[model samples]
Target: MRRSVAVRLSALLATGALAAATGMALSTSTASAATGGVTGYATQNGGTTGGAGGQTVRATTGTAIHQALCGRASSSTPIIIQVEGTINHGNTAKVSGSSCNTAAGVIELKQISNVTIVGVGNGAVFDQLGIHIRESRNIIIQNVTVRNVKKSGSPTSNGGDAIGMESGVRNVWVDHATLEASGGESEGYDGLFDMKDNTQYVTLSYSILRNSGRGGLIGSSESDTSNGYVTFHHNLYQNIDSRTPLLRGGVSHIYNNHYKNLNESGINSRAGARAKVDNNYFEDSKDVLGTFYTDAAGYWQVSGNVFDNVTWSSRSGDNNPAGPNPTSNTSVSVPYAYTLDAANCVPSVVSQTAGANKGLKVSDGSCTPQSPDPTDPGPTDPGPTDPDPTDPPTGTNLSLGAGADGSSKASGTSYGNVIDGSTSTYWSPSGSTGSVSVKWGSATKVSKINIRQASGSGTVNSYRVVNQDTGAVLASGSGTGVISFSATSLKKITFEITGASGTPRIAEFETYAS
Candidate 1:
C-alpha cells in the first residue's frame, strides 16, 4: 500500500506521513513501519485491534491490497495497508466495494473486518500470491512473503494456499509471516497455512514455514471439527513434508517452535485434537509427535520438548508416530499470559526471529531476539544471503565441544551446525538422506575425520562413518575427504547420510586423533 487513504490523504496529511488512532492505534508516520500492538492469542478472543485508529494507507500493487480494502468506511472500517512491491498475478484484479469482497488473483481478505496488511517500504513479496481468509474477523497480517502459492496447476492459481482461513473465521493474527510452498501435492502446491470452517482464535507468531506439502490444517476433514484455538510461537518448520499442523478437533498452543527437516509426520494431533507442547526444538525428523493417517485420536500436553534425532514410525494401521518417545495424553489450560523460551534456545531464537523481514523481531522472553520497535519502520529488505562459504576448516576440530545430534536439520539449519567451525554456519539434511552426529560425553579418539563441505551445499554423494557406541561402520564414503578410520574410541560419532547431490550442507564434522 503506497498511498491512497481515499484520494491520497491530501499530500500525506501535510507531509506528516500518516497517523490514526481509534480502537488501538495505527500510525505509519514512518518510524520504520509501525504495527507494534496486539500480542498473542491475538491478545485473546475479543481483542485483536487491527486498523488501530484507522486510515494509514499505502499499497504497492496487488490491486493495492484490495484498494486498502475497498476504501473502507463500513464492512468494519479500519484500515492500514502499507505493503510494498511484488504481489504477483499481474497487478491483481477484482476490487468491488460496499467495503470490499475482492476476488481475481488472491490476496483477497474476503468479507473483511478490521484490517492491516503490513510490510512497509521495500518488503512484501507475494510472488505466486495467496492469502485468502474468508468471512474474516479481527485480522492483522504483518511483515510478508507468501511464496509459491498454487492449490492447483497454475494460471495464477487460487486456493493453492500460502495462507488460508475458512468461513466464520475469528481473531486472526499472523505476524512476521513467510508462509511458503514450492512442491508437493504433486507439485501443484498446497497448504503452507490453512484452517477449515469455524476457524477460531488464531495466532501464528514470528513465522516461517518452509518447503511444504501441507504444513497446515486444522479441521478440513474428518468431520471437520471446527478449527481450534491456535497459537504457534517463534515458528520455523523447514523442509516440511508433513502437517506441522494437522489438528483435526480443537486446541493448540505449540510454543517456542523450531522444528527442522520434519520430512514426514509432525504434530499431527488427530481427531479429538489437543496439543500444548511446550518449549520445542525438534531437529532432523520423522514422526515428530503422534496420530498420523488417522484412526481418530489426538491429545498432547507434553513439556520442555527437544528431541534432536527424532524418528518414530511403526504403529501400523493409521500410522501413529509420537516418536521414539513423546508423552502426555492431555491436559491443557493456557488462558493467556505467556513467556516460555528455552527449548534449547529454539534454534537460535528461530534464526533471529522467524520469517518475513526480520525487523519485526520479537522473543524477549530472554533467549534474545527483540529489536524493532524503535518507533517502527525497520527492514527495507535485508533478506536471503546466507552461505558465505569460502569453505573453512583445517585442523584438530574434535567436533568442538562435542554433542550435536541430528537426523534431519533444514529449517534454518543447526545441529550446532557441524561443530560450529563455521563455513558460514552449515548443516542441512531433512531430505536427500540424513544423519549428522558428533557426540562426546566421554570416550573420544578418532583416527582422522574431516568432511568440510558447504560452499553452495549438496554434493556429498555417499557417506557413512558411524560407530556410535557400537553400530560400527567407521568409514565408507565417496566424498568430502580425509576419512582414515583405524584408531577408535567413541562416545558417539556418525555422519551417516548415504547419498546426495542436493540436501547436504555439513561444513565441518572434523574429529581428529591422528
Candidate 2:
C-alpha cells in the first residue's frame, strides 16, 4: 500500500522564500507603439512598482492590471500584455481564435523578486495558461505561446497544462515556449510544464512540448520530500507518434534533449527522484528512457545519447541499470550524434560525460572514449540548434482490448504494447498473483471499465480486475484511485495480484476498456 509522495502543489501554498528585501522599484514608459517596445507596471494589492516601455509590460485589463504590472521589485520587471477577447477559466476561446492567441492573467509572485514575462506583438499566445508562477524569484518566462484548448470526444481525451509552476517556486526560467494540443475539460491534467512541489532553481530552456496527453516537463507533486532543481535543456520532445498516456514525476536535471516521433517513455524519473542525464537525442521513439520504482534515491549519469530507431525496455526485477556512472563530474560532458535509421552510417560521437570525454565517446573507435571533437559543444551544449517547424509535434492514440470498436484499429501484435485508438485506456494490477487473458476475437460487445490507482513513487494501494466469464467482481481499488465497469463483453483480460501483498514493486501491466 505505497502511494504517498507527490508534494509541491506550489510549496503547499507558499509562506516564505523571496522578499528578503532589496532596492530599486523601477517603472518607466508612458506609451509608445511601433511594433517593438511596449511597457507598463503596477501591482496594488501585492505592492510592486516597475515602469519602462522597453523591458516590457502591456496587460490591458483585469487581475488588478496583471498584479499592477508584474509585481515584485528588487530586480526584473518586464511585462508585455495585450490579451484581447475572452478571458479566464472555462477555456477562454483557447487563445482568442488565434492572432497568435492571448487571454488570461494573474502570474503571482511571493517572496517578491526578479520577474520578466515577455510576449509582445506576435509573441504571446494563451488560450489558457501561458504562464503561472508562485513564490517567485529571478523569474523569466519568455517567448510564450500556450494553447490549452479542450473538446475532444476521445482521441485519448487530454486537457489542461500549458505552463504551471507550484509552491516553493525559486529561480524559475522558461524560454521559447510553444506548448500545444492539450485534452478536453479544457486540458487540465495534461502537461507541457506542470512542475510541482517546492520547485527550486528551475530552467526549462528552448521549449516546445507539442500535443501532450502527458510527457513534456513534469516534475509532479502531491507533496512529500520536495527539493526540485530542474533543468530540462534544449527541449524538443518531437512528434510523439502515438499512445497518449503520461505519468512520471520527481527528480530533475535531464540534459541536451531532442526526441522525434516519440510515442511513449522519453525521460521518466519516478521513485525517490535524483536524475542527472546527459547529451540526449532519441528518434522514432517507442521507449527512449526511464528510471522507475518511483525512483527512490535513484541515481543516473547517462551520456552522449542518440538512438535513432530507439526502442528499449528496462526494469526486470528492479534495480534497473544503465551505467556504472557517467552523467557528470570532472568538467562535465555528455555527448551523442546519430546515424541509426537502420544504419545509414555517418554520424557518430557518444560520451556520457566525465573527465576528458570518459565513456561512450564513439566516433569510429566503436565507443571507448573517443568523442571529443565532433565540433566540441559539451560541458552543457546549448548551442547549434534546429528543429522548429513552427512548433510541430503532435500525436494521440488510445485503444484497449475487446476489439475496441468505434472504427477500431489495434495492432503491434494486438497490444503487447503501443495501443491508441484515440485514448480512454485504463488497466492496473502488477502485484502479480497470476491471471492474464482478455480476448474478444469476434464481436463480443463490451461496455466500460476504467481504473486509476498508480499514483506517485512506486505507487499502489490495492489491486484487482476480474471478469473471467462472469466471475464478475470487476472492481477493487486503493491509493492512486479509479475503478469502473458497467457492461462487459469480456474479450480476454486477466490480472490476479502479486506484490502489493507486501507493497512497492509492480513493474508493468495496466488495463482499460470503454
Candidate 3:
C-alpha cells in the first residue's frame, strides 16, 4: 500500500490465483484490459479464488452460463465463464445438474463454487434479469451490467435484486459491475445487492449501484443477524433512498467509496451491526450515516471521511444520525490490510474506475488510476504492498472442544480455560506477552479465528496467528477480534500475543473452516 504504482489483473493470471483462458493467451492486450484480482475482505476466508485452476468457457447468453455450471464435474468444480453481449430471461432457462440448480428467467448460481462470470469482448449486460446465488462459495462477478430488474411485476427475477445471495453463502466477490433500476419500489425494483440467511465473507467493490429504492441489505430483518464480515469499497452509490446498505448483524468494513444523491438515509446500520468506515466521500447526501427506522441501534468507527454538502436531520427516536459531524460509536477490528485513497479525490477516482467499462482502471494505492498493462507485468509489477487481511468466516466455533496449550500460564490460570466456553474462565501469560494455542487430534482445515480477551484484562495490541505445522504465519496484525488467512489444514495453530499493555487473559481462541 505504500507504493505509488498500480497492480493489474494481468499479474494475477500469472499467480494461478485466477485462471486464464486456455485457447486465448491472457497476456495479450485483448484479455488484459480489465482490472483483476480481489481486494478487501474477499481476500480472506481461504481467499475467493474464483474459477482458478478450472476450465475456461465463453458464454454469450445466460443459458450458456447454466450449461457451464451443469457440465462441471461437481458442485465445487472450478470454472470461469466469460460473458459478452446481452443475457436476459428469454435466454436463461432451468438446467439442473449435480453441479448446479438453475431456473428460468434468472441467472442462477446455486449449489456451485469456484466460478467467475466476467464480461469480455464488447461487454456484457443483463437485461431485466438478476443473478441469484445461494448455497455456494468462492464466486466472483465482474465487468458486467444489470439493469431494470423487477421483483413484483409482470416479470420478476431474483426477487428483483440485481445480485442476491442467501442461504448460507460465503466467499463471494462482486466487482466492477453496474446494477441500476429505472425507479424505486413503486416501479417494482429492489436492492442492487442483497445478502441474508447467514451469508458472510463477501465483498462488493469497484462497482456502481444507483437509481433504486434500496441499495442493499446485510440481513432480511432485525432477528436475521446471521450474515456479516462483508466489505464495501471503491463503489459509487447514487440516487438511492436508503439501505446502502442496511446492516443487521455481524461486522463490516466500508471505505474509499463515493456516495452521491442519497434521497433519504444511507448506511442504515442497525440491530447491533458494527462497521469500520474509513476515508469515504459523501456528497449531496442526507442522513448519510446512522441507525434509522428502529431503535435496535447499529455502531460505526468513522475515520478520515469527507462530507460535502451533506444534510443531517435532527436526531429523534429512530433517526440517530452520525452527522452534522460524524464520529465513532464502536470499534471494528478486521483481519485484512488496505490502503485508502484521500477522501477528497474519491469522486474522481471512482468515476473513472467504478463501473463495467472504462478499461478496468483501478487505484494505484496512491490516488492514481492505473491502466492495465496488456503486456503482462511480472512480480516486479506493483501489487498490494501488504495484501489486505480478511475475516474469520461465520460457522461453528472450532475451539469449544479443541486441545489447548500455550508458551506459559500464570498460577491459578489453566491452559484449558481459554476454550472452556465461558468468558469467566481465562488463560493468562505469566507476564505481559506470551502465546496460547489450539490443537486438534487430526488435521483441521481452517481459514479464520477469533481472539476474545476476558473482561478487565490487558488489551492485545499486536499478535500473529501461526500455522504450527509449516511454521508459517497465517496472519499478523494489531488488535484482537477476527483474524483470517488462507485455508490451511493443520493439527495445531498458535496465537502469539506480541504486544500488550498488561498481562493478557485470552477467553477464547476460536477457529472456522469457512
Report the number of clashing residue pairs per model: 19, 75, 4
Q: Which stretches of candidate 1 lie over 4 Å from their true place?
A: 1-55, 58-67, 71-100, 103-131, 134-140, 143-173, 176-204, 207-244, 247-255, 258-266, 269-288, 295-316, 324-361, 364-366, 373-514
lDDT tens readout by residue for model 2, 1-514: 2121110000011112211121111223221111111111111112221122222233322342244343424224433233322324433222222112223542333443434444432234555534556555555555556666333332121234456666676655555556666442344445656656565656564456665666544445423446455566545665643312122334455655566666645555544455666566667766555543343434455656667776565556543434222243223222222222111121222212211101112232232223223133221121111111132223211224433211121231122322233223333323322233445565344332322222232433233344444333233222222233333455444433322433232222333333
lDDT of 3 by residue, 70-116 (tens): 87889887776767789987777787788889999999998888888
Candidate 2 segments exceeding 4 Å error: 1-65, 70-113, 116-139, 142-172, 175-178, 182-203, 206-208, 212-255, 258-278, 285-303, 310-514
116, model 2: CA deviation in Å?
6.0
Q: State residue 423's C-alpha deviation in candidate 3, in Å.
A: 74
User: Best by lDDT, which number?
Assistant: 3
Of the candidates numbered 2 and 3, which has the greater lDDT value? 3
Q: How accurate locally, in lDDT, is each candidate?
A: 0.73, 0.38, 0.78
Ranking according to lDDT, highest score first: 3, 1, 2
Question: In model 1, what is the error at residue 158, expressed in angstroms?
Answer: 16
* Residue 16 CA displacement from its true place in model 3, Å: 30
